[model samples]
Target: MSTTPPPDISFEQDALGRLILIAPGGTRHVNVHPAKMFPLTEKDHWISIQSENSREILCVEDPQTLPEPSRSLLLGALARRDFVPIIQVIHRIVRMADGHQWHVTTDRGDTTFEVETDESIQNLGHGRLVIVDRRNTRYLIPSVPSLDRVSKRKLEHYY
Candidate 1:
């Protein structure tokens, strides 16, 4: 028999009435209001959570920006069993030409892995971007509209 403890599990209800699940070594933020559960799989440190309603899968590359409420819920769930949080912030997105090869940089370190893409490269969006860190950790990033106008040149010339 193995002595390793089982993964942690917790659930939260979002504004949209979806129940999200946060598990050890992985996070599953689901829209369960529609009574659907999507299976998320992790391979080599990369985690992909599929959407049952739209057939869309979200790939997370960072966990630090994860909202406080979600993180708190996840931490609470993990703490139930005496395990500590191991996931951290995401560094950057690793762009690849081939669909199979990919990499993600995180505060912990850089992790390389493979994922089967259903379509061509897609943009995260303009409002909030969800990312998964090196440990299959999940987080969200705010993409405020005003940020689009801000540039490195603007900051450098501000003085």
Candidate 2:
């Protein structure tokens, strides 16, 4: 059996710099968000262009298949939307009755947040780690081996 290719959806910003999704379905979807369907694995593929009202304007299988201008526009929006801080150092981790309060220094700046469970700390296949706070803010530890001895020692208790 054979499968046909996906639609050729065009994307461009309006006069006010707002994303416009010109879907093959002929609807000009405005206020669209280019969200990755599988960010961890297919970081560049399987994108869902949705509207402000949660309507799917287009489902792109491979961004590379789209026109360069449209692909670049969607990729730029996805980069801005998924802004997870890269944790550089673990300053402190205070264990409390309900959860642990983490004080870490990220590439951006210093930050503090609470982790409700050990499950919140996920291993992203590689040495990379992603810590999700109680409020659902994600912090990325790019590499475990890249951290200093002191920071690694502080994080070992939970590892």
RMSD of each: 15.6, 3.1
Q: What's the distance in Å from true for residue 137, model 1?
A: 7.2
Off by over 4 Å in 1: 1-75, 78-98, 118-124, 127-159
User: In candidate 2, what are the lDDT values of residues 28-62, reduced to their tens digit?
Assistant: 88878877777767777888877898766557888
Model 1, 1-159: lDDT tens digits are 111122243347677645575545575757522111211222122223334464434433322234667545433433342311221333333445644433443344555544344232223555433334334434323332333233212212111
* Per-model lDDT: 0.36, 0.81
Looking at candidate 1, what is the lDDT of residue 85? Answer: 25
Q: Which stretches of model 2 miss by more than 4 angstroms? A: 1-7
Give the number of the best model, judged by TM-score: 2
Steric clashes per prediction: 6, 0
Can you give the lDDT of residue 129 in candidate 2?
83
